[model samples]
Target: MSSTPPPLPPHALDRLRAAVRLREAGDAESARSELLALSGTYPRDPGLAYQTAWAHDVLGREAAAVPFYETALAGADALGAEDRHGVYLGLGSTYRVLGRYAEAVATLEAGLAAHPGDGALTVFLAMARHNTGAHHEAMSALLTLLADTSGDPGVRAFRKAIAFYAEDLDRVETGD
Candidate 1:
């Protein structure tokens, strides 16, 4: 037999980290149960609440995530600026994934006004615009973002994504 390893069952911390991983690699159902249990223990912990919301989000449980995220945001009112930004980002992402494009745009725009150099928010706004058929504006925003000096990985990805969108739009219009 080959020397390949079998996958291990996820523990609480692994489940927690995987829950927030970008590609949805976690035991979200287990994460929800653990977080719900922890919520009773740490009822006032914004960090725990935020993780719970993120777990719900990754599990495609948008309705379940919203109130938890809102609670985290409210609890973060006295925290650092970065923490507050994170809250809006989570809310904006949840709304976007739920097809609430208008709310995504509005929330992300408000976050952008507060944190002007946020490439992540810019990409998110572009995605909302693209989903809402505002492709031209999306392309413009991505192109504008490409010109920024302090280039982040997300900005680079945004540029590439926008280029792809532009090509797709061309194909649609030209019937190619």
Candidate 2:
């Protein structure tokens, strides 16, 4: 029952769309640079901050992206429901990449609580749990995802990811 967020001004939307295109083209640095340049005009725009953080995340600058993600989230009310919920996944993933498993778990768990049906959040939570040696819980979540043989590509991808992690766990357990 979330209402749609108000539309961005034409100029802002155009810039954001161009930034997205840059990202899709695998030019994260360009996208980040563009977004940063647009920051002054759309200073408090959550979408701009999110794109900036997303670009940094894609460039593997977890430390650099963290603050921007936090900034975007701090002004989350400025975003639509979709963006508000999606930011957690990126932030949680950045935390995981930084080896901050506790923070990752906390961020992902909170997101999962808010969006109970988000498979992405569930998978991330499982990943964080696995990193923390909560192998059983991780396996439980993977198994649940694996049960969804619905032929949806996204579900298939999640299953494959779960399998990859499960294999790692098995190898570790077997000392191989």
Candidate 3:
């Protein structure tokens, strides 16, 4: 049996593109409706599920987006790498906004495991950590991320110190 999912039908692809265009044109409700209609026809399509979740998120319906995001992730093997990454980010962010910090952390951690060195996942993980009262760990992550990725001259000059402090924010240097 072929492990790969079948390619989406041409008509479905065209419709999906149209729905995306509607979203880009600021018609999120129409895009969501179109995506929902398409989903009824291709309920197992990861791309469709992801797009549907995105539409709900854009409309500030985080709770509504959860199941669609879960559906997309459940069939993640059918999604392209970028889409899979996006599903992780979106679902994790949605959970965080909904006050489900633990789920957010777990989802983002899983995403990082799959896509290591992803700045976005690391950043969201930090937020989730903060919400879960892991303040020191959250600060450490943010500081490390800033130190590693910053290009500002001032930040660049202090990168080494920032990295050192990130490992132990509470450690104080004693004058010998």
Question: What is the model-wide C-alpha lDDT for candidate 3?
Answer: 0.94
Candidate 2 lDDT by residue in tens digits, 1-176: 44433456898889889998999999989998888888766666678888888998888888988887877877777777788787888899899989999999999998887788688888999999999999888887766667454476776767766566655545554465
> What is the number of backbone collisions in each predicted candidate, taken in the order shown?
0, 0, 0
Clashes counted in candidate 3 amount to 0
Better of 1 and 2 by TM-score: 2
- lDDT computed for candidate 1: 0.71
Q: Using TM-score as the measure, name the better of candidate 1 and candidate 3.
A: 3
lDDT of every model, 2 decimals: 0.71, 0.81, 0.94
Give the TM-score (vs. native) of candidate 3.
0.94
Pairs of residues at least 3 apart in sequence or in different chains that clash in candidate 3? none
| Model 3 Cα lDDT, one tens digit per residue, 1-176 | 76445667999999999999999899999999999999888887888999999999999999999999998998888888999999999999999999999999999999999899899999999999999999999999999999999999999999999999999999987999
TM-scores for all candidates: the values are 0.61, 0.74, 0.94
* Model 1 worst lDDT window (10 residues): 1-10
For residues 27-52, could you state the per-residue lDDT of candidate 1 as single tens digits? 67777887777666655556667778
Report the C-alpha displacement of residue 97, candidate 2, in angstroms. Answer: 0.6
